[model samples]
Target: MKQDIPAVKQPVRSKILVVDDEPRIRDACRMVLSEQGFEVALAADGNEGVQMIQQEHFDVILVDLMMPVLSGFEVLSHVREAHPDTVVIVITGYATLEHSINAMKRGAFDFIPKPFTPDQLRAVVAKAIKYNRALQDIADTNSRLRTMVNRLTDGVMATDRDRRIVLANPAFLHLIGYHGESVLGRLIDEIHVSDQVREMIGQTLTMPSDEFTEPTEEIACSDDSGERIVRAKCAPFRGRDGSTIGTITVLNDITALKEFDRIRSDFVSMVCHEVRSPMNSMMMQIKVLLDGLAGELTDKQREILGRVSEKMSGLTTMVSELLDLSRLESGLIANEKSAVKMNEILREQVSFHAENGRRKNITIELRQPESLPPVLANQRNMEEVITNLVTNAIKYSPENTTVTVTATVENEYVRLSVQDQGYGIGADDLKRIFDRFYRVNDQNTRTIVGTGLGLAIVKSIVEAHHGSIKVSSTPGSGSTFTVLLPLVSI
Candidate 1:
């Protein structure tokens, strides 16, 4: 039985055509070309050669100048007009300087003397094959790149150092409201870009180098394409010499994303308002009943009603938080900032949560040096952030565990960290702990009641003040929440 084996890969062969009236010359040329790993074809004369050229594609062609029926010059002329990419070499037994000059003038790649050695022929063919392969590769690469650029959905453009448009892909033409004409040699400012995009482009071009600015991602506006949100980025297009050649800008349309956000924001505002009305009514009724305005109740009845009031209060707090978050997102919240002593704020929050902590048998401890640096932040926002952090620490900690609030000065910022000894958060849950409505769904903390918006609110408030917040935690050990705010320079 024949053994089952993979076939050896064959190398790509360059095709060569030999056109000579003499059979001896044709056979000799074919043998020399084939030995050099080329696929060889032959013709008895110039007429036959022209016919073969019309029928097939060859990388290199060897033609004899003098032939029957048709002269070598005619065949060369026809091939040059029809298949200019093919490498053509002329060979003849009757050699002359005029013959070589005339052959080269007719677009012959090389002129071989009569009675040429096989070595000489092989050397010429080898050089032609290398040159042909390089040209073909470059053509293939350019074709592929052009296809890729045309198919892109994101707009891409390149401009010269003087800001003249050098290249614009199809998507870019659609974005700037132009087509058909090659915009390569046109000035970019003359293009029909919408006013908003033009202003952004102007900023990038003319902004002072001393005044550095962050690259903006999205801009919303009306254009010929209707409303759109174009997210663009620009970079210095560089040359091989490591110098700035121009700028390349890429743009992506995010209109759908902006629309979705608008709808979601409106929906949240509507739902929160609807729920608050009924909740406020229930709270008032609960207060009336707790005050004995309804009827005298037994000890158990009062206890149950009291717990009902507490639960109602928690729901009310959550609703208020939702309203606050919605207002913050909508930019409806007034940024009334002032000099805020963080130490005083921390004391106030701890005192307020003392009663709630007592219910859980948890204690709040404050740890900081005297005369802490004041932070430039909204007083109300700071209160909310501190309260949320302390409340969460107490809520998650087991009975008798103490929650500590620490303040310190670091560089130009005030760093406040809240540490708690609770059923610690897992590594995975810790990552998304501050996400709105994100909770650690672990067996250990499943019984813990939370609205899941507390930490998210804290983070939003901290960032709104141009500060930052972060959490550090370990399973079965504990977690620490830290907030950093820029300290008001004296």
Candidate 2:
């Protein structure tokens, strides 16, 4: 998965200050920005804009070139002095060549004409906001790097190509059981406890390529105390002359992830071993009765056997769902979208579950738009989504409650809804209902045994379709599961 830092507090609302001598233009800009989810602050003219700049930081400032008392240039200059970090955009009623050039030379992030369309203004503001955000991100990265260096607990040591000490932290000396001064000028190979490990490190350093190769896996070293493991990562450092100066290495103790991986592997093996036999026996007996291989029975006896068969069928469904969910969580699901009639596919799956609902005295209704559009999706994948949702509705609903399934075309997309009035999900459990192995705690639900992967599988299927699913419910008022899919032209 692509990892990026999560937005801190809804992206700071992209604060924008619009400065213009005309209140009408300022109000117009404010309304446009506010509609686009930006936090807007208005300032009348350059002087007032400067005052706002001093009072608080604005992410991006909009300055009108022609203003009374103070021109846009003056406001830009004051802001550049007070806060060079804030991006300034020149908004002018009259687009003059000289004014544009002057604004550019004076460090304006971008320029926009006063008679600009809302879309044009939006584009300029987006660019300015992105620039400001990039600047802040760079600053944050540098701060984090400095903090990492300062927080090292071991005696850290870094050397250039000439073997001269370029960086050294106090922890490096203590970690090596040596005086800090003694290790500063010492070659890295001079301090090792194992000749083999030292030779490996030497070979890595002497390699012709400038790229640094960190040991990909953990290695253990037997010191006087006991066995200790260290994880090492290295990256080449470059100088201003574009030459590889040396390598930076960070070492960490990794006894936890290894131990956790071992325990997890063992637990999985144990679970698989424990579950395989009973599930197999249940399935074998079900097949025998399903094939009429067992002794002949009367209608009531066959009905009783059918109930047993249904329970085993549910179990099998759960196990299959669990396996698929494991694959998705492990990132084993591939991207392979195909054109599919979403409503048609959903209708077919709903028929199977509708029969199950009928057996339990529940009514399952399927609603499809008259002219449903095809959606880009995976066929078997979306069937699993619909099945899981409808099954849950059937499972939770009262004996005679109607479970309505609806698919409608809406704004270039299709929404599939499954509503049930069995026992509603609580707000707390509703949040985590899609998480693997999550089950609601209550009397009404504990009777229904499940593998807890049904909703999780449904969530994964919806996401794999590049769509989303949401649930809304009141504790006593029932629940609704809605799946949204983008419509694709055939």
Candidate 3:
């Protein structure tokens, strides 16, 4: 079969304008540029050149310095003011150093002496043509980028090192509730926005150039409609030399997602509450039968009932954890807080888990300075955090291994870390360990009893207290969970 070949498109010819008082010079330049595949136009004087420029766009303009009606300097000024992208070249009979410098200072791309050869004209025009094309390309790219950003729904903004707004799309202005036409060059602090957003941007602006961490936060914004949740992410913007120049922030509306999450958490809470009551009653009745309060039973009957009780207990524990998590998600937990001595909390958790560790033949160690700064935290919530971490450490570690709990002061925060010599998590599993009901599915973990809501609850509590939690692990070595809480201000 004969396939049809696609036609190749020819490159567009560059347009050139020659403006001179001399008729012969105009004709000769036009003929030369036309022969070089440029669309050429002829103008008699500087006034004629300006008229032609107004009529149409030209890639390059060759104007004579000494002309009637208007000087080349005037035409250069017009081109620079009106069509800054158009390349201007000067032609002069008086080709002195001063003339060339003045022409250049007036924005001329290059100048050629009047008594010149065809090759010299071609060389200078060729250079101007190349420069003009590059400028056009850059302008086109910038236009396209602006169009794309303007049409986006997500808000995008950029700031300079001085925290002045350098670029912003219409969406950004709308998101920030700004009614002005432009905010360029205005200080970011002048804009009305949530302090959380401003603080995030400030952090990115002050971050080390070598660090490319992007900080993200979900903040609530109120308007006529209602309260809207916006997720703002900020990162350091670097220059060509890899130095931090400013910051870029992107805002996305996530109000619907947050509402959906609230609905889901409420539903889970209801379900857990209803299930827990009946489960507890059934467990109580089962215990009665197993204790021979109702009647004596055979060995097999007792064994079956025991197994059922065990399964029921597991289910009950899962329900309780789910309810706790739901409450955390609904912002009903951790409401009451005060200055808490973290060292005391650490000591209490270690002592509480010491018996369990000894039953498994594992050692529990506590390491801390005599005195430590207190953290602003809920006493019950902090106790839960320490209990969950220590219990997990002891549960995961093998016999004869040691679990270490440490507390230290880090800047304005208190650092609590629990290290365990256990079957560590894989990289893929580590990312989602804090997600609700997410459990590692390895063989070693299959034997471990967990509702998988412990870490999720820990994370929620930490964040509610304006703190952070981090985990690091190796495959066979162990895992370490670290929490940082702001210290109680004096």
Candidate 4:
């Protein structure tokens, strides 16, 4: 009779080592395991088994207790001490309670009698292989986790419910002037480094978990290299059950960011001062020459002087805006409130910007006031705000575009708006228009002569008065800027 058989898919073969003194038992065991898809190696005695284990890796080891050269107990001890992850099974005819207990106490996986069946032997080996794979997985996961925590730049530390440090990364050890051995198995508050650091940790631990956020403060430290700044934040540490066990703190160094801001602000102030002194002198001398105080000039010479004066005027406007920006950034500008009428300020600003309007033939229109509210604000700052807005509208609008200024009183406050017909700002540039030195880098805005300080100053001056300003615009259309101020002291 002929029979058909189906093929069974098998997992990768597990490795096994068998050490027995009897040749017949070894050959029988090898034949049975080889058919079961196991890679088996043979060792004659306990001594030979130990030598093979020392040189190769195996998932399971089977040893006979009664052997020459070395006993099974001695080999079991060596395997447990050297390769604890390898599963070991002891085989012996002397299978008494004392022998089984002794093998188990020496870390044996299981014990088998001398007259064991093929099924019983395969069952024991399969159980040992399964247990070994679990241990291998756990060890591999721990190795990967350790590598991540060890190489983190920001210091990471965790404590237990008893408030004792359970884990500290390498960065944490380096941050607080302590070695890894010193920080482990120690108390967090017991750290004797910076008092500020200790206090920060103490405060964070006592606070509710919801209250902990990012870095609370930056600490200044002077070292051999120079001054350094470090920021620290602490929050609740969780256990496997998602319950707060302790606090975890992270420290980041940010000395360079703070230094860069300081350097940039100082450079702006210095350049403005250095350039303003000489430019002011040149303007005064040129004014005298144009006024004919030096000599009467011909028509051609007069035209040339006028052109020079117009270019000088543009420079003067830029220098003034730069000075205003420097003052705003340095916190030198103050808002000392005085009673001011919106209608009066708007009329004065429109008159002052009349020449700018004539240059582009743009009409500056102001709605005639009926009843208007007065706000308490610094007169100079209030005037500067209106002037900057009007000047920008004039500079950006095309020929004969009408710029309208409107004033109204709304619920104990006054709303002043300046609307213009010009090429509007793009969405990306609109958000950053008031940032210092941020000019739009597009075709419509690049040709305009500005130091990018006009809108920044306008924003600062309006904010200083405790007023709010907002804008809405569309591309190819125009923009409307509205400023709100308290009708009475806010």
Candidate 5:
């Protein structure tokens, strides 16, 4: 069985072009490179090399400096301008330091002296091949990323530390209504964007490199189409060394979501309004029956009616709280503002809740500086804020505990705190305590009666008055709720 087997062909590693006036040198390069599995082509002079390059693509180009028609320097310049990806190496008898420097400056990858061995040529070519591949990989990755960003629906933009726009996608240009030819290297302030977005970016850029907090805001933008709501989020952009070098802003159009929220709030308000009148009438009728105006009632009948009345009262309170939340969301409550003495409001709330605290043997104490500054706020709303906090404190605390209310001036703002010795909230429940209808479920809080809307309404009112609220709690210890409101300019 002596059957002859055909030889298998190996794929060429690279395509190389050798251009020289000397026929012996040109032939020698072709033989050496061909033996190393490279597809090699020869040229008599620089003119022939350039013509072959124009006709086809080559991975590496080897040229001699002392060419007859066109010099290697000319070929290097042409390759740099036309096919920059192609690696060019210079081979010459005049391999002096000056000639090597000149060749390098002209964009030659590396220099090889005349009478070079095959190993020397292979080593230099291998290094050039590795570098060239790395550059190609980077270019490919950048191209893919740009394509992905351009096709996204959300807008993405990046700026340098100097506030100059470095990268902006097509979606960002459309969102900002920019029809300019280019936006690169332009200052963010010069661009026709919303002031809120510019401020967010500016703040993020100026933040310390160690701290990373993304600032987000809903901005109104108007263009030829119409006015729309855009939610812009800005964060610090960090470099390889983990230092912030710039800022990035991502924008999403939320016009539809906002419209949906408005519609939902309107529906809820209408339903609450219609049910409120009928519910009030029912409550009055129940009160009259309890008073024996309809007829004389037995103890069992009275107790049953009392339970009904209590449930009705809870429902009425829930309805009212929902209505208040609607009004706050609609900005109706924020319209009424005046110079209000927070200390006076605190005194009135403490006195009002005194009896409720006494029933549980809990003391409601107020500590305030004598001459506290007045805050620009709605008096009735501020009173509600105090009422809710004091009521919660008294309701949640054990018998004979004290709920201390304090007011102090803190740097152009009035700091109000309501500290309660109660079954403190756990770390998990503290996060959503201000959310509507969210109640902490546990044994200590099970018997307590509440609509779970007090803290939510308080938070809405506080934010509407340009104030802030925060809470700190430790399990089984106590909780402190603090409010900070800016003082009115005297």
Candidate 6:
């Protein structure tokens, strides 16, 4: 049996209508446009072309001037009124200055002479289509951008290199305490907070071409109430000839975040003081009982008491650390600067840690140069700095492993280092090791124990002494903690 098959029709192409009195010109134009994938229709006169345009949709129309019945001007006007988007190109055999001008005035896209080549017609037609398409694309993109800019909550402002505001979002207007009408075309310094910002703007603008290419850093500006921090990014804008004509800047406000941090720090200090008062009294009572000032007890009872005392001691230390950290962050812990011997301080700290080191079977080595500079620091703060680092070294290190405590003068500063051969800090914890209540290791369970304030207190004390502390470690190779103290008042 034979099977029946159906033929499929190709999709219709874009339509083009040709209106000319000359039969040869119309035929030639139709043949060229038809070969170039346009569905072509021919009209003998201007009236016929207008009738065709009114009846059907055409993407482009080629009309001839000086027609027999109704002139090309009549057809052009009628098509433009009825089908506004249909491109109208006038074709004239006897080209005249007045005729070409009239066609353009009547909204004709282009006027082609009779002697024009097929390639010329094709190029002009393609260019006109591309131009219209590009214009439509730009309109659509602009509509979307305007909608987005209006909807955004953050302030956004774009300025030319001349520092004049070009475009600004509603958020930007609100942030700078202004409205659109007040800000446009105004220099940045006009709305800028103070003399400092005005100077910064001037400096940045006057910067050599090389430096201005990079983004501006985070800047702080003082407003009516307080300071506001904002991150600013800048990029050079170039013109059609690719020369840097201006710059664009984006500002993001971070004032609320900074204020929140300050409030949190104050609350922590209040809580730490409350907790420290009670813990200090409790530890004092425990110390009295352990010293036998309360009464006598058996060896086993004393041993049990000793363990309890040790744990209480840990709690007391934690409370002290909390107080120290709170004081440091709140800026309440100012250094009581004094010119004191760094070596004498180190020897005393090492001697104190040596007692604890002996129980762990760890060797404590003190390396200090005899002629050491007197560091400008509070004695108590520097002592705590030494004690915390040395105590940490003892805790993490194994039996008989060496803990080296060294103090030496370098570059008008006293450098104290505690080097330990122990389980070193993990890579992830290195950056935040000094943050309060942050600890490294599975040994950080409340049972395995720490108030997690050791490094934090150490950091606070070092800073209070007008010093900086740094720690470097490897997973197995062990760690080195260094404190740098200025030799003179700073």
> Which one is best on TM-score?
3
* Model 3 TM-score on a 0 to 1 scale: 0.60
Model 5 weakest 10-residue run by lDDT: 330-339
lDDT of 2 by residue, 1-490 (tens): 9899886684458889999988889998998999999999999878788889999999999999888899999999998999999999999877889888889999998899868899998899999888999999999997897678758864345666754556655554434444534555667666643343344345445644433233323456654656656554443455665455665555555445556555755675567557766877987886787667886777887788777877777666665666566566543233335457776787788777778988889998888866677777767788878877888888887787899999898898888899988789998898899888898879888778787888888887788667899999988668999988987531
- Put down candidate 5 lDDT per residue, 1-490, tens digits, no spaces: 8988998886547888998899998898888888878889998998988888888888889999988769999988888887898988999899899999999998998989998998998888888777777877888999999899889999999899899999899889899998887889999988878888888888877766544556777778888889888878787778877677888888888777678767977888788778888888999999999999999999999999888888888888898888777667655221435557887888889999999999999999999988787787777889889999999999889998999999999998899999999999999999999999988889999878789999999998888768899999997888999999987542
Root-mean-square deviation per candidate: 12.7, 16.8, 10.4, 16.4, 12.5, 15.3
Report the lDDT tens digits of candidate 4 across residue range 177-206.
565356777887676456665665565456
Off by over 4 Å in 5: 1-13, 185-191, 269-490
Sorting all predicted structures by TM-score, with the top scorer first, yields: 3, 5, 1, 4, 2, 6
Clashing pairs in 3: none
The lDDT for every candidate, in the order shown, is 0.79, 0.75, 0.87, 0.79, 0.86, 0.74
Better of 1 and 4 by lDDT: 1
lDDT of 4: 0.79
5 or 6, greater by TM-score? 5
TM-score of 1: 0.47
**Per-residue C-alpha lDDT of model 3 across residues 1-490, encoded as one tens digit per residue:** 9999999999999999999999999988988889999999999998989999988889999999999779999999999988889999999999999999999998999999979899999999999999999999999999999899989999999899899998899888878788875789999888887898789888877876544556777778888778888878776778877678888888888788678777887788788778888998999999999999999999999999998898898888888888787777665331535557888888888888899999999898999999987776778899999999988888777888999998999999999999999989899999999998888888788877778899999999999889999999997788999999997542
Candidate 6 wrong stretches, greater than 4 Å: 1-111, 117-119, 180-206, 212-234, 238-243, 267-490
Worst 10 residues of 6 by lDDT: 209-218
Q: Measured by TM-score, how close is model 4 to the native structure?
A: 0.45
Q: In model 1, where do residues sit more than 4 Å from their true spots?
A: 1-13, 18-28, 41-56, 61-124, 127-131, 159-167, 182-190, 194-225, 267-436, 441-490
Worst 10 residues of 3 by lDDT: 330-339
Superposed by TM-score, candidate 3 places the C-alpha of residue 246 at a distance from the truth, in angstroms, of: 2.5
Clashes within 3 Å, all models in order: 0, 7, 0, 0, 0, 2
Q: Which residue pairs in model 2 clash with each other?
A: 154-171, 154-172, 155-171, 155-172, 155-173, 156-172, 397-422
